[model samples]
Target: MKVNKKMKTSALAGAALLSLQALPASADQEYLLTITRPGHLQVIDMSTNEVVRTCDVPGKFGTGSIAPSPDGKIAYVLSNMTEDVYGFDIQTCDITFHAAQSQGNVRVKTHQSITVSADGKELYTVQNPVRHLPDRFEVMEPQLAVYNTADGTDAKPVRTFPVDRRITKIAATEKGEVILGGADIKAIDVNSGEVRMVTALQSWDRGPEWLPPDAFAMHSQGEQSNEYIMPYVTAKFQDDTMNMETAEWWWGISRVDLATGEAVRQEIIPFEFIVFNFISDPRDPNIFYGSFNTLSKHDITTGETLALYEMPHTYYDLNISADGKTIYVGGTSSDISIHSSDTLEKIGSIQLSGDMSTSDLRVATIRD
Candidate 1:
């Protein structure tokens, strides 16, 4: 995944440098985990299992992952069909920002993920772009843009680095660095705007167990050579009891070191296809946490995977407490569950008014 050493200078010349000086000190933080289902954002309070409020979103409940600013004041929602990203004020419940694609040669086909910088000045959006013109071998490139937060306006493209492969996930590191992964993971220098393929990850070999039992977890590779196709239900299982139930199905977790272009650790996490959206131990950058049906804690330094917690089955999204003491998971096996990060024990669970489905959980901590 390492870039050619010769291209380093040209790639990162005079890009905006990341500033964490303004970032507030970490403290006991609470968050609202939003899960999408029929067509609502189930806002669950982490401190107490209570539906503090339910916000109505544009598309289906979970059109795309939801992200809150580090300060916890603003939340951004993306749409699968539209090119615009919506902003919500957590305190006033008002839509403050409506960030649209202001500049670009092509229209964004699928709006994937929206991440914000640590200083809360910019919103980084990752999207797929297609040329407006027809067939001339027009390329479909992975687009990245930085939108100003002062006003819900148009975003400008900072850099559109070439990634000819599939990018399934995009995340902002604790230090305000952007990490993109699909069949492979790449770390882009936020300040310098240099994108380096961090680690090369090979896709799982397809087989019978990879397909779903009732057509719920069908797997397919689009556009690429129709060389491999399998159902998603045939996912590998660790805990057989939960594996029998469709509610518990997850791919796995892998973390790569940006300094070195290699995967430090990887584990086959049980549960449905769920993307982790929370920092496990914010104080210690190496420790992070996430869940789908089961909760996990991974240490990138030592490359160790530990079963931190598990649920009754249904688990959608999660966010870490500001201080990294507790994890708030959105959904219902029977109810929404909150677990202590240190002990990995269930502290509380509460039922929500909305039904939870297979949706990626996005969470952000705000200083209260």
Candidate 2:
């Protein structure tokens, strides 16, 4: 039986409308979508920074991975409670559909393993079991499951195929291919299921000691000013020599060229601070942002650290507006903190109706 979830709008103040009306309107609407840890969704009006609507997700312990529809009218989330996926209408803040990622003793979703295509017609995610009890659970090879968004409530994978064993995050390209980023970056042909490796996270390593990536650092992969940004941290390179052990573990950002499939690594000056999420400036691709416990700005061009600010709490997710002005950070709290992207200054905060430990904040465009 599906669990009963609450769906309601927060008590928005009338004065809030007056403030929202003051802002100049655009052809497209903007909203901050927050998925809480208590398993709920909150859609906040970016104009007033107010919670316009909220819906309790079906799953209890929801994962931090959601992809907004092309129109931003709906969000398809890969949930973990019972290992299923649910779609919520962005307008009504109600459950629109529910489809299990795996069925009958099978499970999926490692972390941030869900994303929609560029055109927003399909969904992609990695299916990995959570438990490995010998007799109680049946362990299976990890696979990539593709589903059609139009399928509605009982949606099932139109096609399922084996992908890399450790793909934690999934994204798509404009040219009609799936980009899986984790320990290694690769492309897969949806129709043909051809996996082509683009590059490894340790691509910058000069010696044979290749460092595996911290997959938790990955967020949604989207084009910003014609360039794609990927944030990831690498595991330590343990060596008996004191110099190697004392040497800081390098964090990196991968910049990929969509046109030519050329991927380059931007290694940060070793261990000043750790950045686990990626947010790049739309106007200037050279400039990028990263956050987990702290928000950081980086100039990948000259390998220089620009600014760093500690967030109130450790946030697992981050998002930026289409105009490249405001930065939204959520995922581990009831409030979505807003900041000036240019300065990383706290500009405002929107408190959710419930203390829904929201996970991922996805910024997308909604049509008026």
Candidate 3:
């Protein structure tokens, strides 16, 4: 059975409406962000830096990935639990409709990551079994599903691509290119619909849910003007090392050569445990930014570490405002952190209703 998940305004507070008369024009712009914690979606004001509102995402209907359509008219919330997608109107704060269902008998599992194309017409989601047997390490292979959004109805899955091993995380590039990062880094060809194995990580590896409490909580906070690098580490033993042990886990931002399935660049970052959830620059495709246990930025084009900032709280995910001038950081921290993209400064921060590490944030644009 399909269920609906919605948030109410009573749970939110309006922006403080403070004036920035002396500040630049860009400083006055505001952004509305939604984050998941337990059963609630905490809404934050990018300008005021406060938890102005809170909405309840139904407990049974878990929210996986959150994205806003191009024109900023509608937001898409993917629920792996219900095996469905919900569309919300930004201005009205209402559930408009559900995404078109997977077409031609294609099905989706719970907890899969979702992404929308740059043009905003296509929706890509990855599905993996929610539960797996522990006895045999037969990982749940992931399948990539695609959907069309024009009809404003249930999207039918157009493609079903598979992965060799279990996937830990997934991301999309500016040109609508898909890169899957985790224990192994892989890429998918959106045009040709081809999936290829790019590279296998040999260091710092771990299964899901390995992050410590402090790093996990700090990762939920997303402020501070700096870049970050985390070291990848895993257990070491004589027997484990002799048999090609699975000691290394992959973390941090990875740079890839899309034209050729090559993970041309990568770096081991600090914080042994923390899953990353954040956004990359659309304007500067090579400039990647993210936060988990810490905050960081990197330029793939120049192979340089731009900056790394340490956060007092853990940030689970990050989203950029429509213009990329503002950033909304969500996580378990008591406050919602906002940053200046240009100066990389923490301009404002507000307390939210729930802990950080909510859902993945997606920005979509609608254009005819």
The most accurate candidate by lDDT is: 2
Better of 1 and 2 by lDDT: 2
Runs in model 3 with CA error above 4 Å?
A: 1-32, 38-45, 50-64, 80-82, 97-107, 110-112, 129-141, 173-177, 199-252, 256-263, 268-313, 318-328, 339-347, 361-368
lDDT of 1 by residue, 178-236 (tens): 66655545666666677765544444443434322211111111101101111122244
TM-score comparison, 1 vs 2, better candidate: 2
Q: TM-score of the candidate numbered 1?
A: 0.61
lDDT value, candidate 1, whole model: 0.53
Best by TM-score: 2
TM-score of model number 3: 0.58
- lDDT score for residue 205 of model 3: 40
How does each model score on TM-score?
0.61, 0.82, 0.58
Candidate 2 C-alpha lDDT tens digits along 1-368? 65334322222445577779998876677887867666667778887778787777876666657777767888877666537778899888677767776555555655667767777788877777645465776667777788888888898989987876666666676666777776678888877888887766644454534455554435663533444467666545555342555555766766666555567765654556766577678878777787778888888778777888888787766778778898887766677778898789999887765553435677656877
Q: Candidate 3's C-alpha lDDT?
A: 0.51
